[model samples]
Target: MRYVDFTSEELWKQFLPGDHLALDTIVKRHYNLLYQYGCKFTRDAALVKDCIQDLFLYLWHRRNTINETASVEHYLMKALRRRLARALSKSGSMEGIGFLEFKDVAASPDEQLIQQEQKAALADKIKKCILQLSRRQQEIIYLRFYLNASAADIADIMQLNRQSVYNLLNDALNKLRQHTGAYFKPAMALSIILLLVLSQL
Candidate 1:
């Protein structure tokens, strides 16, 4: 059926009719993204893995009741978040989740040694600066820049008003600028910052 050429919505339609291939394609395409997003909530890799499995199982069982959607990724991310939250809450150990952790950014071997060192240093500094933000601020930054999600998508994922998403993103950027040292070109600085942050993911 050339699922590669199918839009996510089309694949979703096929999945609704109990097409195992379509469901498999959807899982293969989104599993990594779901795993990464799930990690943002908890460091427990096993828990995240189990939750993702459960998410897919739930979707498969309820396929007949699922609604049409333009973005399968968004739907999956929102569902995963809710499922993880509920699991954590039930365990009464939700307090430690949601803190941002830094993964070491990889350096290109082709880059000059000095240049690589400078980038590593900058990434370390940015990681420290981001850790200073509130959990919500870190989450907003992650969704907006790292995930490249539109404000509306973020609003739906985070359950915030659309305007609130914009406001919060702006405020998070401002806080980042305030906490991080001055850069002559704010726009360029932001690009570099997001690049370094995303590299870890």
Candidate 2:
């Protein structure tokens, strides 16, 4: 079986039957996205690492219950989001964003060094901004983007009405706009802002 050639759903089916190769292939393909997202939620790289490791372990141990419709990324994100929520609730802040302190958004060897520097600076500022939001704002951001929850899915995840999730997401953006600063380029500013929002959530 060419597990590498399989779709997420196909790998999932094989994995359900206790196929370790299929399970391993699925994890290898999606680990980067999961790790990056894991970095976003907590100050402790160890905690994020543990969460991802544990999540995949649980998947292997309980593959039979895995949802057929969920893509590999969705399952990982959903589990990670739940883990982050638990972590945030315990730590009492989302952007205790300490892991990779964004202190030096400085010039790089790359010719677009200045652009990269500004982007990093914006990301730093956005990270601080995430710490300022209410807990509800943080949770909403998690479900909406990192979890890739649709408005309906977010509403379900967060136990809000559909319109409420929409309103909260817009409000979070408005708050972030005020945080990233007025002089920043809007497009670059927003991309980094959303990154911060997703991370802290």
- In terms of TM-score, how similar is model 1 to the real structure? 0.87
**Candidate 2, overall lDDT?**
0.66
Where does the lowest 10-residue lDDT sum fall in candidate 2?
A: 98-107
* Candidate 2 pairs with clashing backbones: 40-199
| TM-scores of the candidates in the order shown | 0.87, 0.62
lDDT of 1 by residue, 113-172 (tens): 235666666556666677766777778788877878899998898888999888877876
Any runs in candidate 1 off by more than 4 Å, and if so which?
96-99, 103-121
> Model 2: per-residue lDDT, tens digit, 1-201?
787789988888888879999889988988877777666555577878888888889888887776665556666676777876677667777553222333223323333424566656666666667667666676666556555567776665455698887787788777778877763565654445445544433
Q: lDDT for each of the candidates?
A: 0.78, 0.66
Question: Which prediction has the highest TM-score against the true structure?
Answer: 1
